[model samples]
Target chain A: MELNIYHLYPEHLNLYGDLGNVNCLKRRCLERGIEVNVVNFTDDEKPDLNDGDIFFIGGGSDRAQQLVYKDFLQYKDVLKELIEEGRAVLAVCGGYQLLGTSFIDKQGNNIPGLSILDYESKYTGDKRIIGNIIIETTLNLEPNKLVGFENHGARTYSKYQPLGNVLVGRGNNDDDMKEGIVYKNYIGTYLHGPVLPKNPHLADHLILQALRNKYGDVESLEPLDDEIENKAYEKFIKLYGK
Target chain B: MVNVRSMIALYAGKFSKQVLKLINSSGTALPGKLALRIDNNFLDNIEEKCDTVIMVTGTNGKTTTNNLLNHVIGTRTDKILSNLKGANMIQGIATTYVNNTKDHYDYGIFEVDEGTLRSVTRYVKPDYILVSNFFRDQLDRFGEIDNLVEDVYTTIEKLPESTLILNVDDPLVNKFTQLPNKIIKFGLDLDLDEVQNSSLSMKNCPLCEGKLQYSSHVYGHFGNYECDKCGFKRPNPDFVVSNLEEKASSQMITIDYGDEELVFEYPYTGIYNAYNVLGVFTVCKQLGLSDDEIVSAMGDFSFHLGRMEEMEYKGKIIKVILTKNPIGLTQVINMISNDERSKTVVHILNDNPADGEDISWIWDAYTICEREETVLHYYCSGIRAEDIALKKKYDNVPLDKIKINDNFKEIIDTAIEDDVEIVYVLPTYTAVFETRDYIENVVKSN
Candidate 1:
């Protein structure tokens, strides 16, 4: 089956390797005999979301996030409808902030978010999180742990319960708070570009879920070589594993 | 009797060496106590005492150009102070002055940071300024290339008609040659190899809003070009590098000034180093160095500590190339990625704030084509190890062909395990030092 992926704010939210998210998904799906159609939407250009199966928004600077906020406001209603309709969606970093209620920049400027994820982001004085980060998560639907990369300055606080618990790295807030929002068919986090590349299992989890939801109880494909996967796993365990 | 401050300041040379060693050992940030104890504002007190001061500033090639100028002057009896330890900021400059001053130096050959160039130049009062080029770097701190250019120009405006040595090859630096100063320009003659592969000349012309057309690009935005509407052209350089030839082993660069031509057999491999050699030759000839001394010194020079520094690690030859930007990484990839023979590569990426918290730049670097079949085994390390491995995998490098080692020690061991002919390491700035420390310890233990 053909899949359409909408990448929002390619220019602004591309501060980190966020483009790698689109590339990773496209590559993985193509390898599994799937045809993925990717469309990059930026500035005032509207994307044709009628056939979109998944939507992605990556991260950028505060200035860039504000610019994207101005551009994304035009399609706020459409984006909300898509999320409500169970179209798979992922928002990371500035994109995650824009998916929330509001974001306060370092200079105290407030920008409105889409409020898709019931969370708010506030700029904290602490800027650096220099090392590796590991997320301890068990999706109710999936058996494997969710692993990805995290690099951000904005601390997101939610009055409501977080998407999940933080196992390794600093999450949404300074304290033990949910790092991102994961609701029915929607995933939003501060993890910046190439989140899927570093965590192939996470990418597989998302794609497999989307596929299973559409195709129903599809048999699993043979995993990649164990030797290589084990080496990668050992590396992750040493840095962020318990 | 000398005061306590003077006593400590006099021995600042010894203290600076010890501090560098401490930084190497601990892998810690710049020590606060050392910075506090050393009087970095010593330049303010002696600005009126010096007759001439020259500040060379740019992202890359500043150190080489500064060292060349220092070597060419050959006024050994004269006192000279410079950022010899790769310290290019205000504190670094202050530390250099504090360490080198027994008396007023005849010339202060310093390399200043691009963002701090304006303030540092104002305080240092440079008689001569050598600006190499302006490229996109450290977006969080520098914002854009134009901001850095403005900073350098503003600082140059304040200087007293002293000489401005610039690279005409770079459009940004070439713009300064038009300014009111005793300006000298240096550039490379566009050859077939230089012009054929110009991918990075897409930026708008600084002179006109019109698109830029290049006869050829050396690398990044450095190339020979002419504006379509404004009639601004790449001028005949005061110093030109010609006869560029690269063999399997080493590269040769020939620099031609008005009356003399010096052929330098460069120890390093890439055209970028040739530009650096050209910058050095321009400064040397301008400062009155004989062709013989220039040629002699060129052969004797060694790559600085973290640059393309080579070392024997685990009975294998390893070449460590420091990559901070796309252009730099592209050069590293170009130099090694073409060889069909199987080779091992250790790619490291860090998330340290100093490393620009955004690790997304790695995607741009990894997109450069690698000879996948010849790349026997790839190792990715650093805080962003998995991210790098994922990038390589996305680039169609087989999943089984690459290894991700989070622990740097494990990565090094894996890289050095086989009897590899050449191991290519590309690392970010933080990773470069960390990798260097790791290699040093491994070598010492063996």
Candidate 2:
């Protein structure tokens, strides 16, 4: 079995280890005897969204996000199709905000987004949501309290199902008692603990969904021992909270 | 009186320093903060009097470069004021000034934080402003790197008299051209060895949003690069490393300073430290230090600002290299991978305030995989041991070769007990101190 992973706008959005999610996903797949091919879609090149079994994007700085904003639009229609077909998409902070309809900046400017989901982010221009974040995710990734770090300035609001409830740090808009937007096979959030290695379940979920997209129906991926991942999560929750 | 507030602040700061010292605290930033509160002109008053005030600002190597300059210059004259312990904000700079106000120093060397450059320059006028290289660092505290470069541009815009020393090899630093003031640029020559990849590429040009192409790619997004859309390119460095040869525990480098060449055996390894030495050398040369003086000073300098340290624990040689960011971590990983010695590499990570709360950079760094032929074992310790454990495990490190132990003592011991020739412990800022203390305690007990 093989998986094709497309990294979107890595040149621009490679801020804060967002590529780790792809590495983790690829590693898990390889461990289970699954071959993996990673194709990075950077500046100027057109991404073959059809070849994508699992699509990943990390967060970028503001200028960097704007740099790739136009290029990102090319993925909207194809990404929606892929999501509908049960393909997995894991978008982080700025990547998470990009999937929304629009973002309101400090001057109340409504910057347009990809509109892959019905959500919007607003810059508070106050204290940034920066800290260790633990969320009770309903994705049923066992030890369901997902651990990661949040260092974003904007708060996102989505009417669709949330990825998780905020057990500790601020998630989404900080007041929603929620974190991230979850729809179909797409999971977008402000979790930058690269939101994969420590939270092994999410990494596997993306892999499993990618496998399903390839084979139509799949039972599950062969489980590898997640002792390190779980222990890291446990240590995070113990040192921090929730 | 205009001078009354300054005088009171000076006396009060001195009294507070004494009180803190008596109370058994070296109080690096607090005394400065109090002085700034009492008189905002505290740093200005000191800067106005100093003949040569050098501001060293950058994401990394600020402490190392500042200390290197201080060490070389101090050999000539004891009339020097410096923040040697790395208190580098406006408050920290203020503290240094308040403490050293009584002395009519010839040189006031300071390690100014990159983010606080504008804040520091607004009050004080530096004779020479040295900028090393900029990287994405402490994002939770400083926001982002683009903003930092912009802030630096604005900071340098108004300072007409301050001579700007820059690292032109870094494409980001190339944006500072067209400035009115004198600029001295330094970088590694294209002839030296280059790294395979950047910490991660900025892809687009820092000047224009155009595509950036590198003729020679060094570690991180540093090297001889040019922009396609705009005609922006890496400036020819005034002081370039013409030759760089790695010795056993040091680097033999020959720096070309346009008119003369300064050849010296740098007591440190890595191109990162080479850049630091080059920056220091540029500043020293601009200060009229002869090539021989610089060579002598650099050859004799020993600065262990907790960057990289070496010790023997339980008869096993152990080396600790501070691993904070992706580029720094990648450098260490590459160093260990190239090492022929049988070694146990330990990664100690912490999520404290000192260490960026976001531990995502760990994933962004190079992985130690498929090179386990030399390294015997891997131990993950510190508060975030499990995080790095996940990193190694996914890096294709066999489970038996990887050990996850949060206890620093036990992990360090386990690593030392491995039949390897060396034990390499790479720790974050907070972890480095704790790990060092543990090692020192072991030596003391023996």
Candidate 3:
């Protein structure tokens, strides 16, 4: 099986090892004997959003996010169609905010977003939600706790259902016990432990979704022994809470 | 009255230092922290006490470059003060000043932390300031690289008479040359053996937000870059590493100052250290150090501590290197990968207050390390051992080969027992001390 992943604005939006998500996915696939091809779409290149089996957009600074927003607007309809088709997608931190309706900065000005996810993020106050985050997530159909780190000023509020319930660390916003937006095969979150490698179940889930979406049938996938991965997850869960 | 407040602060610093020594502690930062609390004007009084003050600040290379300046300058004169202990915050500078106030110093060299440079500079107005380069570091402490430069700019704006030494290869730092202060630029001007590509941290031009295109991509968003849209490019540097040749354990290079050229062998490997040397050479040349003096000093110089410090551990050769951010870690990984030794690598990670709480940078560093075929066994240790292990595992290191040991002693023992002839140990800021102590006291003694 071949997996084609399109990294959106990787040059601009790759911050704090956010590209590690892309590396984790590619390496995991290769280790599983799945051929992987990654194509990076930066400021000038226009990648066919349809050609990609999986799509990834990592976090960046506000300036970088704004620059990417203008470029992303050109493919707004294509991205919406891709989401509607239930294509596997992952967005993190600033990229997660860009999937929303808007992101409010410190100056209280709204930089409009893609509006793909039913959420809006605002600066609201000065305090940034930063720490190791663990959440009870069922993206794999089995109850599991996902671990990661979140550092963002924009507090998001979503009308749609969240990806998981917060066990520890501030998620989405301070008031809500919810974190991330999970719609169809699309996932957006503030969890930037790059959010994949630390949580092997989530990485495999995304991979399974991408494969199922591509070939239309995937038997219960052979599970790679995740002893170390699980150990890492449990370590974070024990350290952070829950 | 012998300035009773200053006297008290000095005595407090001295007493704390003695107590820390009695307790067998390095006490790098706490003594200064206490002295500053006792007297706010402690650093100010010391600044008045010194004849010349040279301040260095940046995310990385501050300690290495500060050591270089102190070594060269102190060789000529005994009356010099420097923060050799890597205590670089406001209180730390205050502590250094309070301790050194009694001695009549010709120059006070300090490695000022990026976050506290502005506040620290308010009192100790340095006659010369050297900014090595800026990278996204200690994100939990300092927000962004863009904001960091502006903070340093505010400090530079205040020091109108100070000569600002800069690294023009870094576009982010190159922007500071536009400051009204006297600018003395230094950069690498050699044909890079490999393409120098910068990290995602520096994609857009600092001036116009236009994309920066590199003619010769050197390393980590550093190299000869030009913003075609804004016409902003790397300015011509005065002190340039005209040619650089990387050797097994050192760098052989020719440096050019105006019309004069001096060939020197820098006793350090990696372009990262080359940049540090260039910063030192710039200040040394400005101080009128001749070619003979520079060559002699650099030949005799070695890294202060855990910067690629090698030792025999349990009858096997082991090297310990201090790596902080993704950029610096990438360079260290490259240095290790280039070496043809059988590599049994041990990574020590800590998320203590000193090490950034966000451990995302490990993911990037591991990505680079994964590219190397030299690594045979990998051990992850320290507080964030699991995080580091997960990174290595996902990077395609076989699960069985990757070991996560929170115990440093066990990890060191395993590394030593492994059949590999040499083991490369990579550690973060806080982990460096613990790993060094373990190797020094445990592994070596055994």
Measured over the true interface residues after superposition, the C-alpha RMSD of each candidate is 5.2, 1.5, 1.6
Candidate 2 C-alpha lDDT tens digits along B331-375: 778767666778888889887877887787787777683367887
TM of each candidate vs. truth: 0.75, 0.94, 0.95
**Tens-digit lDDT string for candidate 3 (B60-127):** 89888888888888789878888886889887776676567455788889999988888887778899
Which CAPRI level is candidate 3?
medium
What lDDT score belongs to each candidate, Candidate 1 first?
0.68, 0.81, 0.81
TM-score of 3: 0.95
Candidate 1, pairs of clashing residues: A16-B360, A17-A193, A17-B360, A18-A193, B195-B216
TM-score between model 2 and native: 0.94
TM-score of chain A of 2: 0.94
Q: Which regions of candidate 2 deviate over 4 angstroms?
A: A104-108, B191-195, B312-316, B367-371, B413-420
Superposing all C-alpha atoms, what RMSD in Å does each candidate have to the true structure?
Answer: 5.8, 2.4, 2.3
Candidate number with greatest TM-score:
3
Report the lDDT of model 2 for residue B155.
86
